[model samples]
Target: YMLARSTGARIIVEFGTSSGISTLYLAAALRDNGGGRLITTEFEPSKVMRAKANLAEGGLIDLVEVREGDALETLSADLPERIDLLLLDGAKALYPEILSLVESRLRPGALVIADNADFSPEYLERVRSLAGGYMSTPFGDDVELSMRLG
Candidate 1:
């Protein structure tokens, strides 16, 4: 996250922020970089509130917007065509659907960092197929999957 933020990427979207545990990490990274935004989605309203509270406790409320609703549906309608980083942490069953949505919206140089990817067969295959320049990192592998549109 530090490395990615160092690139000065401005927009980030995250799915499945169940409790904002991961959200904190992303928010901290973005805050460290001086300026950035993290739009995150959670299906459960309660989880959304909890996440918001958690982020607030972590002093990251201003940097993260916790959207409450079906992540896929919300993203399909609202996600911008230009996203710098996308973190997939939603439902395992809906992984494919979200993947397609992300691919359709991702900018050419945008990066997709998936968590629990090892759990999804389709995800592994898709990542393996799409990643052109791959780098093994401490958390997982970073791959240059596509190029952002100008």
Candidate 2:
């Protein structure tokens, strides 16, 4: 929430929307930011339905679009010209691929937060590398927080 609020994020892309818990947080941030959009993906149709209900119950349905499909496809197209924030909490092994899909759209200094990133050593190395164009460091336990450098 702080990241979204602090960044004044207007467009957020989330790799996972398991049960809409994290989605709620991001949607709240968008609402608090005075209006924005959140694009989150979930391959499970049941989970997607639950998430939509949750969002509606929270009165945040209007700010979020819960895409029911694989992140690789859902996040691949029709994205805003500039993405302010990205949350990676889906398949750990696919972190690098997901990052690549969103990398080009990330505005300069945009934040990228990854949960349970230890499972993807390649992803850690990529974000931590000086030449990767991201300034990154571990945040808390297994979360890696990075910002696009350019």
Candidate 3:
């Protein structure tokens, strides 16, 4: 929420919408940012149903479009020309792949947050590298905070 709102992120792409827990926060930030869209992907049909229900219940459904499929597929195309934020919380092993899918669209300085980042050593190494185009650092205990350097 802080990251999205503080950055004035108008378009957000989330790798996972597991039950819409994090979706609500991102959508709320969008709402407060004066209106925007959140494209979130989930692979499980049942979880997609629940996530949609939760978003509607939270009155954030209008601000979010929950894509019900693999993030690799759903987020591969038809995205906004510029994306302001990305949250990686889906399959731990797919972090780098997902980032690659979204990389070109991330506006310079866009924020990328990954949870339990230790699960993807490759992802960690990529983001942490100074020449990878991201100023990356660890946050809290298991989260990675990085900004697209362009």
TM-score, candidate 3, is 0.98
Which model is ahead, 1 or 3, in terms of lDDT?
A: 3
**Per-candidate TM-score against the hidden true structure:** 0.79, 0.98, 0.98
Q: Whole-model lDDT for model 1 versus the true structure? A: 0.72
Candidate 3 local lDDT, 8-70, one digit each (tens): 999999998999999999999999999999999999999999999999999999999889887
Per model, state how many residue pairs clash.
7, 0, 0
Quantify all predictions' global Cα lDDT against the true fold: 0.72, 0.95, 0.95
Q: Tens digit of lDDT per residue, candidate 2, span 74-107?
A: 8899999999999999999999999999999999
RMSD of 3: 0.6
lDDT of 1 by residue, 56-86 (tens): 8999999887888987777777666666777
Error of 3 at 91 (Å): 0.4
Clash pairs, candidate 1, are 107-148, 108-146, 108-147, 108-148, 108-149, 109-147, 109-148
Model 2 clashes, total count: 0
Q: Ten consecutive residues with minimal summed lDDT in candidate 3?
A: 64-73
